[model samples]
Target: MKDDNLGDSLEYTTGAEAMGDGLSRARTSFGKQPVLGILALVASMALSIGIIGLLDAELFATWVTFFVVICVPVHIVISMAWELNYPSFSRKLKQPLKGAFFMALMLLVAAAIAVTVHYAQPIHAGPPTPFVLMYVIFCVLVTFWFVIVWNCWPLSSLLDNRLLLGLGILAVAYGGGYGLFTLLFDFDAMSAAPFYSAAMDPGGAFPAFHVLAYSVTTVSVVFFCLLFDFWPITLFPILRAQPLMGLVSTIYILGLSAAVYWMGVEWLDMEPVKLMVNVSIGFLFGSLIPLIMFEGKLFGNLRQPWKGIAQCAVAVIAAVTLPSIYWELAPLVSGPLNSGAPGYQYEFWMASALLAMTFPIMVVVGKFLDFWPLRFAPIR
Candidate 1:
C-alpha cells in the first residue's frame, strides 16, 4: 500500500510541473509577438483619434500634435502598474478580461477626477455643472479605452521593463518642478491662465503655438530624446549608475539648457538671458524630468560612481555642442518662411530646429560613443 501511494504522489507532482511549464511557455509565446501588439496599438489610436476628430477637429489636432507626448507617459504608467501586480488580477478573476476591466475602471476614475479638477471653474458659469459632468464622463471613457488598448497591446518590445521606477521619477521631477515654477513665477496668471483661454479658442494662434511648443519642444525632448531612441543612451552613461544617477542626470539636463541658450543666441539671433530662462524651463519639462525617470534604470547595473559622473559631464558637453552646430546650419536647408501664413512661423521653426537637433547628436553619439572604451567606460 505504501509503495502504491508513493508512486501516485510522484505521478501527481510530475503532472503539476508539466502543467505549470506549459502555462509558462504559452505566456512566453503570446508575449513574444510584438508585431501583433503594434498593430493593435495603431488601430486603437486611429479609432480614438477618429472619434475625437469627428467631435472636435481642433482638439483632435491638439492631440495629434502631442500624440506621442501624451501616449508614452500614460503607457509607461499603466505598463509599470501591470508588471508589478502581474497575475494577481488574472488569478483572482480567473481570467485576463476581468483584470483588464479592473485596470480600465481604475484609470477611468482617476482621469475623471483629474480632468474635473483641472477644468472645472470655481464660479458657476451658465450650465457649468452639466458641462463639467459631460467633460468628466468623456475623459473617463477615453481613459478606459486607452487602458484597455494598452493592456491588450504588447509593448514590451517598444518600452523598457523598469517603467515603474521611471514613472515615479517623472511624477516627482516634472510634477514637483512644475509646481515649484508655478509658485515662484506666478505661473497661473502669466502662463496657465492665458494657456487655458487659448486652448479653448480653437481659431487662436496662441493655441497652436502653445500646443506645438509644449508638445514638440518640451514634451518631445523627454519622450523621444530620452525615453525613445532619438537621443542615444550612450550620451549619458551615468544614467546607468546608482545613488547619484538621478541627481547627475538632472544637473546635466540643466547644463544642457545653457547650451541651448547659446544656440538660440548664436543661431536664432535670440536674446541670451531670455533664451537661458526659457530653455531652463523647457529642460525641466523635457530633458531633466524624463531622463531622471526613464534613464535611471541604468543605476541597477552600475558599479562605479566616479566614472559615471565623468561620463555624464562629457555627455552634457556633447549634447549641447552638437545640437548647437546643427541649429546654426539648419536654416540653409529650410525653405523660405511665409510671414503671412496662418500658423505661427516661430513655433514651426522651433519644432523643426529641435527635431533637427536630435538627429546629428544621435548619429555622433551612436557612432563614437558605442565603442568599447566608452561602452565599458561606465564602470558599473
Candidate 2:
C-alpha cells in the first residue's frame, strides 16, 4: 500500500556546478507539484464519498468486502511482484491512463469474486455473509503473512513468471487463510446471520471477531514496522535478512497486535469489529496521505523511531478525527445506517470507505503512477 523500491532515477550533481546547470535527485524542473498532489488526494476523497452516497450502506459494505478480498492480492501481484512489468499488457497506453486500466482490472476481478460468492451460496447451503465476512477478510491477513512476512519465500523461488508467481502466492494466501479461519474462528458468533448458532457453529477456539480483529491489527502493526523502515528488527544484521527477518518480525508483530487488541477489548471494553475498522485499518488508511499521497518524502530525511513516531502521531490524529466526520456524514450520504449498536450494526460503511476505497485510490494515483500529472523533472 506504500511505495517500495520505486522512484524516478535521478543523477547526482556536485561542487561548483552543483548550483549551476547540474541536476540532482533533489533538483527538479517540475513546477508546482504539491498542488497536484493535493488535488489527487481530493479526487480520491470525493470518489470515496460519492460511492457512499450512491449505495445503501449495507450494500456499500458488501462491495467493500469484495474489494478487500480481491484487490489487495491483485495489488501484491501487479504492483509489488510484477512491478507493473508489462505496460504493454494495456497496449502501452501512457501512464496515468495506463494506471487506470490496471485499477479497473483489479475491480473487474473483485466483481467476479462477488458474483461467485453470491451464487455459490446455493451449494454452500448457508448465507454468503460468512464467506465474505470471515474467509475473505482473513484471506487478506493470511496473504500478508506470505507476501510481507514470508517475503514470498519458497514460492518466489519456485515460480518464475509474474503471473504464475502471483497465482501461487494468492493460492497460498487463500489456502492459509482458510486454514486459519477454520482453525481459529468460531462462526457460532455470527452463524445465525448476526445471531449465534451454537449448534451449527464450527466451535473454533477464538471468537470470529476476536481473530478477525487481531489479524487486521497485525497488518497495521506491519505498517508501523514499515514506517520505521523495518526498524528495531532491522537494527540487527543477521535477523535483517529475508525469511529470518520476516519470521522474527511476524512473531513480534502478532504478539504486539495481540497485546493491543487485549487491552482495547478486555481493559477498555471496545468492540472488536469497531476497533478493527476505526483503529487498525483506519490508522493505515489515514497514514496513506503522508505515506503514499506525498510519497513519504515529507519525512524521508528523518532518522528511525522519530520518523516512525511522527507518522504514527499523524495516523492517530487521522484515525480519531476522520471517522467522526465520516460517521456524521454516513447517515446523510449512505442513507439510514445504524449507529453500529449491537443487533443493528451498520456503522462500518464510513470506515470501509476510508480504508478500502479511498486508500486504494490514493495508491493508484500516488504510488503506481508516480503522482502522474506532476512529473519529476531535472533542474533547469
Candidate 3:
C-alpha cells in the first residue's frame, strides 16, 4: 500500500511540473518580443512630457527634468513587470526595459493623475475623487501582480542591477518637487492634500498628485518583495555593497517630510518659515526615533520598512500634539523662565528632549512585542 501511494504522488508531482514548465515557456515567449512592451513604455513617456509642458511652460523647461522626475518611475514599473514576467519579455532588453518602461509608465500615470485633478472640483487642493479611487485600484493590482510574479518566477533570483536606485531617485524627486511647488503656489490647500492628490498647484501640475501615489506604490511593492525574502538585495552583500537600503529609506523619509511641509505651508498659505521651528523640531525628533530603533534594520527585512514607517507616523503625531499640550501647560507650571524670552528657548529644548526620550522607548517596545506577531508573518 505504501509503495502504491508513493508512485501516485510522484505522478501527480510530475504532472504539476510539466504544467508549470509550459506556462513558463509561454511567458518567456511573450517577454522575448520586447516590441509590445517597448512601444507601450515609449508612448507613456511622450504623453507625460507633453502634459508637463502644457501645465506650466515657464517653471519646467526642456525634457531632462521631466525625464528624471516624471519618466523614471513609470519606466521602473514597466521594466519590473516585463523583466520579472520574463521569458515573456526578452532578457537582452530586461535592464534597458526597466529604465525605459519606468520612465514611460511614470509619465502615463502622472498624466492620468493630472487630468483627474485638473478636471475635478477642488476641495481645497486635494486629489480628485477619480484619481483616489484609481490610485487604490492601481496599488491593489500592482500588489497582486507582485505576488503572482514573485511566486511564479522570482526576478531577484536573476537580476542584480542598480534598477532600484533609479526608481528611488525618481520617486523622491518628483514626489518632493510636486509638494514643494504646491506649497509655494497654493494657499488653503490641505497640508496632507498633496500626499493624497500629489500635485495641487498649477506650477507643479505636470506630473500632479497621483504621481506621488505611484511612487508610493512602486516603493511599497519593492519593499514588500524584500520583506518576503525574495530579494537577496535586502540582505548582507547588498547591505554593504552600497547601503542601498539606508539610502532609499532615508531619501523616502526626508522626501516625504519635505513634501508634507511644503503642502502644509501652501494649505495654510503661510510664509516659508512660518512653521519652521515646529516642523524642524518634529523632523529632527521624528527622524531620530527611526534611527534609534530601526537604524540598521531600516530595510533589514521587508516588514522593517513598514514597521519603521509606522514608528515614524506615530512620532510625527506625537511630536505635533505633545508640543501643543506642553506649550499650553507651560504657564501653569510656573517657572521663572516660562514667562520670558528664554521661555521659547526652554520650550524648544524641552520638546527636543522629550522627542529624544520617546524614540528609544518605541524601539524597545517594538523589540519586546516583535510588532505583535506581524514580524514573522509572511508578506501574503
> Listing every candidate in turn, what is its Cα RMSD in Å to the true structure after a full C-alpha superposition?
16.3, 5.9, 21.0
Error of 2 at 236 (Å): 1.3
- Flag the better candidate by lDDT, 2 or 3: 2
Which model scores highest in TM-score?
2
Model 3 is weakest, by summed lDDT over 10 consecutive residues, at 2-11
Model 2, 1-380: lDDT tens per residue?
Answer: 12222111011111112224232233343423355556777777887788768876666666555655567666656556655554335434555666777778777766776566556443444433544556676776676667766667767655666677767767787677666766887876565475344543556788877787788889888777666666788788898556687689878998998898988889989888778887787776666655666555556568888888876787677678766776777778877766554533554565467766676666676645655655544346
- List, residue by residue over 1-380, the lDDT tens digit for candidate 3: 10111101100121113224431222332222233223322333334333333432222221222222222233334332332232333223322343344334446665654454345534434322323332322333233232222221223333333354324333433444434444333322334543344343344333432333333333333333332332333445554222344454345444544565557556865433324335544444434333323322334344644654654564466457755654553333323333223123333333322332232223222222222222223333
Q: In candidate 1, which residue pairs get closer than 3 Å at backbone N, Cα or C atoms, i.e. clash?
A: 240-298, 240-299, 302-380, 303-380
Where in model 1 is the C-alpha error above 4 Å?
1-34, 58-75, 81-87, 90-99, 119-178, 184-242, 257-380
Model 2 Cα shift for residue 264 (angstroms): 0.6
Candidate 1 lDDT for residue 223: 27
Candidate 3 residues lying further than 4 Å off, grouped into runs, are 1-240, 243-254, 271-274, 283-302, 333-380
Best by lDDT: 2
Off by over 4 Å in 2: 1-36, 87-92, 115-127, 191-202, 374-380
- lDDT order, best first, reads 2, 3, 1
Q: By TM-score, is 1 or 3 better?
A: 1
Judged by whole-model lDDT over C-alpha atoms, candidate 1 comes out at: 0.31
lDDT, model 2: 0.64
